[model samples]
Target: MKVRTEMYNMFDGAKDYLPVGQTTLPKLYLILFLIYSGFLALWAYICNQQRKNVDKIHLVMGVLLLLLTLKIICALEDKRYIRNTGTPHGWDVAFYIFSFFKGVTLFTVIILIGTGWSFLKPYLQEREKVVLMFVIPLQVLENIASVIIGETGPATKGWFRWNEIFLIIDVICCCTVIFPIAWSIRSLAEASKTDGKVAKNVEKLTIFKQFYIVVIVYLYFTRVVVSIIGAKVNYRYEWVAVAAAEGANLVFYSFIFLNFQPVDKNPYLVLHELEEDSAASAHMWEENISLG
Candidate 1:
């Protein structure tokens, strides 16, 4: 019970240092809720606009988005219990349960998003392919981190060390995803300068892409550096730093993933002009022109 009290004090100390006028997990939860909700709405809109039927991937993502929302709620409950009981160890088993759910929810989301992006290769340019390849590994790393988190327990003696390892992997993934995308977007922007309308769409998309990438990177570094400092300073607010680090991911992914969809390939676009001309001449004067 004494350890529990100390843990509550730990939470209080962390909460005190949160963005002045804000509670720690609750604030983060509210923001995440809004972000995910917006994403769900956007996905629905995209689904409606799709010319063909919604595929299994879209259906899966829709389901995952809902589960992630539930995870936010569970995280809020954990935060509340910790705040009230001051026990970060485990509260009647809810701790492990919540951690497991959060891990699974996030892991599923990251994998699905990455998989969906890869499916978009038909529509992606060569530079996009490079950026995507770099992103895929990072996303896999993040998923592995989540799996590790789910396997470890808060009260386990070596849990913190394992968690730290997961965090390191997470940071690596976030950095890889960010810098590669940023560079690719910059390249696309520069190349598209002479093309007008298409260029404008690319530029607009690039802006948000760059913004989210930078935001993810900034938050990742901020959380990582603060955690290192917190560990060194023996600060009572170390959990706060951890929360901040995790929060960065929650926000960035929720925001950016909404705009991602599985791109369809245009078979016609792959044909050369010469092939098109030949096909046209071959079809000339024919009642029904069909390519075999």
Candidate 2:
């Protein structure tokens, strides 16, 4: 009789603690993220090990996906805890850490894609590396500040906040990357007119450029516009919108990887090298004839 009474009391307490009107969408998104992350990690490892020459961009992208997967998982766990316990916990800190790393990795992937390995190497050695190092730390510091100053719960007023300001800064950084990417695409197009090899390579790069632009648009819509809507309405299910957006982003990334599987097998690799060799040979032959 005593044990039964105790069990009944515990059950009642748990019932009382359960969050009101909690939805399952966030949890569903987390499950999807886990599956995708696992698949991507396996795929990335196979590509890195099996390929004759592994592409650095693939490796970086794999790392970025993994980081994002971890961030989502942590965020999901944090949300679960809050719903069950009606209070914040250490999981929130884990979410923040993973989120910060994911952001950094995302930017790194963008830079790698925008410049390509050949150009990125020298650019990183000169000015870009220093700028990135500073920017990442500052962005993290700003996020921490926003957390401290902003409301603990969902935004109840306008979208404009210290955090939103940092998001604008991030948008500007993405815009800067677009300029370089656009220039590279234009240069490739011009070179393609005379060089068939360059044309083939340009086609491959165009696919990547299209993917990048789509992702940028998605980011702006979800990260900026959705945030504004959630804040203005103080939606009870704001996390659902965020989770849905992230799930969509992951789906897009998965589609890209599926379409462009195995970087080593890309025709661009061979064509790019051939074009470079041809250019070098032509220059050398011209110099020799002039000297003779």
Candidate 3:
């Protein structure tokens, strides 16, 4: 009887200490899924009309899907179903260290976005400039929140379900980049329409487009993996991995923009002028030779 009573007491204690399950997230997930599906349908329509215009939209949608998947899996893991014991023991300290670095990484990306946008303001429309600026601060705040929730682990086992908000922000911030990128694709398409040879070279000109999509997809999946582990093992630390991924993303975008050129009006004029000048100079040389 004594042994049975002790076991019951332990069970009761465990039950009492267990983290609270999310009461509202399921509804939010349903809503998010519905909204995302609607957007996907819209993207499909756009793609049918203009393939280039939809490329960035589709890419961003994929990233959002991956982030949402991560949030859902992590939430499920936190409930301790499926026997998932997240990270190994003695990992909490390491997790915190990573979180710090990741926070710094996120902050750095925000700065880059801000500074880059400021420099690009002359080229971008006012609305695009404003949206880019808005997303920078929001993304920074979301990263800060992630760090705070991560550090709260090993105690109550869960924060205020902040990951949900972070996921939403991720979707929005990624879309900020997506909208501009999509515009670029449309610009490319228009340029191609004007010149048959340039249109034929579309494949070459847009080579970097695929890389942008691939990097965003990679980051999305990594974030999901970290979220699942954080929630499953009661270990909420994703700073280092997240930071490294974001750093890679920063570099990738830098490369993309560096290689991006205005493909419409300037190149043709410059090439035409060079050809005419060369022809005139050659004619003058031929006349001098004939006279001699």
The numbered model that scores best in lDDT is 2
lDDT of 2 by residue, 1-292 (tens): 0001111124455422223323454466578677867877787777867676555666776777777777777767665665555444676677777777777777666655655543223344444465466557666765664554433433544435655666666666656556545655665667655554543546646755775686677667766777676566444565555565766676666665564455554553344666657765676676689899
**Candidate 1: which stretches are off by over 4 Å?**
1-64, 77-164, 179-183, 186-190, 193-209, 212-222, 225-292
Expressed as tens digits, the lDDT of each residue in 1-292 for candidate 1 is 1112323124435532232222355667667767767777877787778737455656666766766666665556555555555543443245344445454444444433332333323244565456556655555555555555554567867767767776776666555445434554555566444333342335344554655555666655665575675567434444566566656665665554444453343221123445545545544524244432
Model 1 clash tally? 1
| Residue 187, candidate 1: alpha-carbon lDDT | 52
Tell me the whole-model lDDT of each prediction, alpha carbons only.
0.51, 0.59, 0.44
What's the TM-score of every candidate structure? Answer: 0.46, 0.71, 0.40
Give per-residue CA lDDT, model 3, range 136-178, as digits (tens). Answer: 5776667666666654543544456676677787766665655
lDDT at 165, model 3: 74
TM-score for model 2?
Answer: 0.71
Best candidate (score: TM-score): 2
RMSD of each: 10.3, 7.4, 16.4
